[model samples]
Target: MKKLIVICLFLAGWHSLLAGSPRNIMLILGSADPAVLQDRMDVALRLYTKQHFDKIIVSGGCAAHGSSICEASFMKEVLLKSGVSSSMIYKEENSKTTVQNYVFSRRLKEADGTLVMKPGDTVYVVSNHWHAISVAARLRKYDNLEAKFYIEGSIDPKPTDKLDYVSIFNGEPDNDKFVLKGTWLTPQAAWQEGDSTHYLTGSLVYVTDPQNMRFSVYERRKVFSGLEPYAAGRDLRFIDAGSSWYVWNGEKLLHVEKQERKVRSILSLTDLIPGLSPAWKYSLKAGAIYGDRLLLFSDSTLLVGKRKGKIFEIEQETAASAYFRNWPYSWGRGNVSAARIDPQTRKLYLYRNQECLELNAGLKSVQAPQSLRLKWIDKSK
Candidate 1:
């Protein structure tokens, strides 16, 4: 009987040890309100103290006045005051955006070796209640780490405002209708919907292939009310009204248009990159420039020409290959831009005005080039 009782006690102790092991906690701080942010931090610190996480990484960057201090610094200060040792708290202060917070925090591991954890190592990520989903999705991209999230309660005790609730539910903030920043490639003609005559604040409309709707309209002004339609059998052109026209191919800024559009002087890859030359010009059936290659789809064949000294020369060696004969799987009516290649994933990402799409190799896939491998390393010290 004495031996059996000892065995039962040992099992119970082992279970407790397994349950109580510390997890690596990453806390994301949002907003610039000092009082509210501090309240959230206080809640996190208390939770950390109770659960006893192995280490804490605080994330945030510069904000408005009175809230200008980097969030990580403020968090580190609070943790130190709350009795968490300096050695156990890590600060990631350079991240001005939420995604950057995760990227920079991973970078912190280099300075503090303790931040490195192997596979199966549990991690706890804390962020505002509404932003939990996006943060989780981003973290899920990393196959090596497993993470759970906690949301700090809002400082305001009142019921969440209707707009605020909607924003949180939609995975963004409630302050703006739809924030439109950065240049966009839109069709010259678009169908306008709704009775407003002017574009509604958050009106949704299809740009091209009226049958197969594309991007939605976010913002519209009196001068730019209607949607740009898809002109078939006609050349599609864009005339920049601004003093300096910046031509963006939906990914990177390609070149600046200085003169008006005319047959003699047309926008070419040579104008964007200083030393490239234009080998030939077609009547604009399907033409686009990505990196150093000028791709044109015409006469049931795809032509890829190389740029050399302000001149483009067609590559005759592989000209017979039909790689891009049926290229551009889909082009959004709102923006006809090329996808931006992610160095980490080597996959092209397309941003159609408001929406985003990931370009894959497709049904019959081909191996990716060696250059696009994941280069992330454990920087934890």
Candidate 2:
């Protein structure tokens, strides 16, 4: 009787896992190319028609050609033309990136224009094959949403595939459309006057680096107070890129200081935590902060430590695989500079170049699932 009871319990758990999987799916369109959007929408409509999902959300914003038409608007037209009921379609027209598409669209207003799903909603995400991994990671960051992704097609293009498919319906031809140029912005600095009584009478400094591409510091004081020289402090120090020496005063330029110390590469510098100098003994390639412990990755090893303390090495062999597996796909080709730790699931998320994959703790494996193949329906008259 004891053995039978255990078997029954095991079966129930397995069933629950399958049942809990997400059914509400979201399809993300990368480009405003009309043909591409139509093709993608056709697949999504067919998938929704067959599945038990309650709704479909299309997300995209502002074309690169400077026109007002958005990706979501294009998709809505195609979906409506395909016979899908207008009531079931949702549009998120403000998102300009893949991550924004999933994040903004998932919280779309209902038919009555009220927000749906409080939090902790399971959602499936769809996009092009190359974009599936990264989209999933960005979607996962939202604590309220659980994301699964599916890819559209293979990277290798087929002869039947349309060359101008993605740009067909746009106002301008594909050749005339403006392509989004890749660029990075520098961080700005600001400061405020400090209270004299608090022993910080000089000035309170604040640094803002939204893109994490550059760093800067600013000083501010009362109109009556004189400008004081910014001294070398543990919190802020400029490292000279040409030499290994430190700059006592902040440099006018916002370039990474060249270090004489033999380091692996620029990729190794990204792991430098805020308030922690780049000259630490163990260089961090990618890392994230969790409470008092700092999770660091370098080469193929994982290290955890506190600020200004020794690093305790964790598993080394699987660190590289685990890191690459969790990286986002939008970062492009080179190395990953971003990572995040999910407090709820205790899962580590990494974004390397343009690929994003997840590392499961139990299996210790990485899996990238492509978009589901839609039953192609011939809509030709």
Candidate 3:
């Protein structure tokens, strides 16, 4: 009887340990206005009273006004005032945007190299109601995160920012109503979603049939194809159910999705990087969504976004840095601007100027780049 009782107790203890193993509470920063800051803190204190998490992760860089103060630091003051134990709070002090909040905080890990918030850990995101929508959208992109989100209202509400976010959810980039336009080929972004090929040509977004290159429908304002750079599977667990695509139309940032078809892997670069400029004014220097990661190439730095709650970065001397060396004014067109994965899963292809280079799957090395053969592209047009 004693042996049997001991076994039962052991099982109970193991289950308890599993339940409390990864405790993470993340707070998204708000305006530095004292009243707004206090409101955010009040919401956090309320949640803490119910269940004090192992770590309270506060993220945000500045409190606006170009002051030396950061949002995370401002929030820390509120936490201390609210009586949250200093030991239990972890401040992510360098993030200025929502994406930075998620990326920088997730990089924090324990001494043994384990992530502070593991796959099964619960995450609580506290933000203003409007900001919380974008917050939830960005957070839910992580397939492994088990997050519980909460939003608070500002004491003096600002409708402009709030309405802008609403426009994004509605699939309109730049917070403007979708406009119609003519057929053109100077595309802002081009992607093959599922079997259908989509191109945001000029001011319009277009979708083509897989079997026969025929018009299916006009996906207006959906041309910011840079958003979901990686769609490899038939995954459908986005925070917003109606989202069929995510695109960035110029200054208008749409956290929208285009569910025109299904696939095995999907990757998005938006809200994944610490500091990213998805605006059309400053397009990504080079980016690709291959497999579960969105590969971004800026200068020599490469950022890999992992869907399983972690980001792994790879830095290497790019092969294209030497490409087109023989050509005059190579600096204008020689740099690699994009990458694509071969369906066979054996190699990756990178585009630079007029050449296409093939690399091993791991992207550690590459073959000599060859001039692209555009057999189908009508140069006459």
Candidate 4:
């Protein structure tokens, strides 16, 4: 009798496991290119026809083309046209780069505030063949060994894959056509200020190369000069704080007016954080601005602080030896100048000397670092 009872219990446990199947989630990566976007949609459509998922997440951000139309939004419009129901599709518009595509998409939530992605769920990453390895690596690192991942590669667009931009924007204003105005350049430091995204780029033989550095302002698809040849020294770095701008002037942090280019000293960072002084030892660099707090990255540490009245208070400190280990050239050697945050997403971006890293709101986990670029589209074409 005891042996029979054990067998029955084992069978019941197996039945429970089989009944609780993992949810299927298809993550369609975003692209600004009409051809690429069409291909991704095509792949998603095919996958949906074969195996319908609980949710289809389209991921991309406006930083891709620098216009109001984000990659996810554009992809969503086409997906709807392609017969994918609005109920099944979710747009993730906070991702500006490939790393962001995975990071932001996973955090997507349902109407009930429950997480769309959960442990034991199966996530299908739909992207081009080129992103297969990179996507797999990110999935392993970010998924925290909870979920299973599959990559559906759309190597190239089919001959029949045609996108109708006219139909997509039919009901909209004729002047609101999206078009690229100029060449897209990789920036040393990038940040979002108000309605515009700013890039600090130039010759970077030093941390803040004042001799050749200039600020390019991207709004929509139009690129223009935000600051034309602003004068400063080698020890200067620009930080953006939503509505205003601040600068680390080698010795003290200062608030600067964009239009007038006037500066007021805030406080000496070295005095407040002694570990960051003596440039040779620490190679201190301002990383990004989060709310009222300022984030600074050194050779081996990530120091976060907030200004309280007349003094600056240290908030948190974490060992960032691993971050610098991957970036060997150090701070001053590369273009470690411009750092910014996306106003809509609240994700902090650290434009280092080598690559760009996307940090979550809490500054805890970081998306795999990659080159940072901004998209500018002339919507008023």
lDDT of each: 0.42, 0.42, 0.49, 0.54
Please write out the lDDT profile of model 2 over residues 1-381, one tens digit for every residue.
Answer: 999999999999999986554446555554656666666766676666666655567777644334445677677787778776777676665455554454455445543333443355555666554455545544455334676666666466567754333322232222111111100110011111221110011133223343324333233332212212233331122222222212122222122222222322232232333333333323233445444445554322554445444232332233443434443222222122334444346554444322233445432335552111122211211
Model 2 scores a C-alpha lDDT of 0.42
Evaluate residue 96 in candidate 3 and report its C-alpha lDDT on the 0 to 100 scale: 38
Candidate 2's C-alpha runs over 4 A off are 1-23, 65-68, 111-114, 157-381
Which stretches of candidate 4 lie above 4 Å from their native place? 1-21, 63-69, 144-381
Q: What is the TM-score of each candidate against the true structure?
A: 0.35, 0.35, 0.39, 0.37
Better lDDT candidate (1, 3)? 3
Find the 10 residues in a row with the least total lDDT in model 4.
Answer: 175-184
Model 4, span 105-164: residue lDDT tens: 655666543467766677777765445344544454445423333445535645663332
Best TM-score among the predictions, by candidate number: 3
* lDDT ranking of the models: 4, 3, 2, 1
**Clashes in each model (backbone N, CA, C under 3 Å)?**
23, 23, 22, 10
* TM-score, predicted candidate 1 vs. hidden true structure: 0.35
- Give RMSD (Å) of candidate 2 vs. truth: 22.0
> Residue 269 lDDT in model 1?
43
Quote the positional error of residue 78 for candidate 1 in Å: 0.6
Worst 10 residues of 3 by lDDT: 232-241
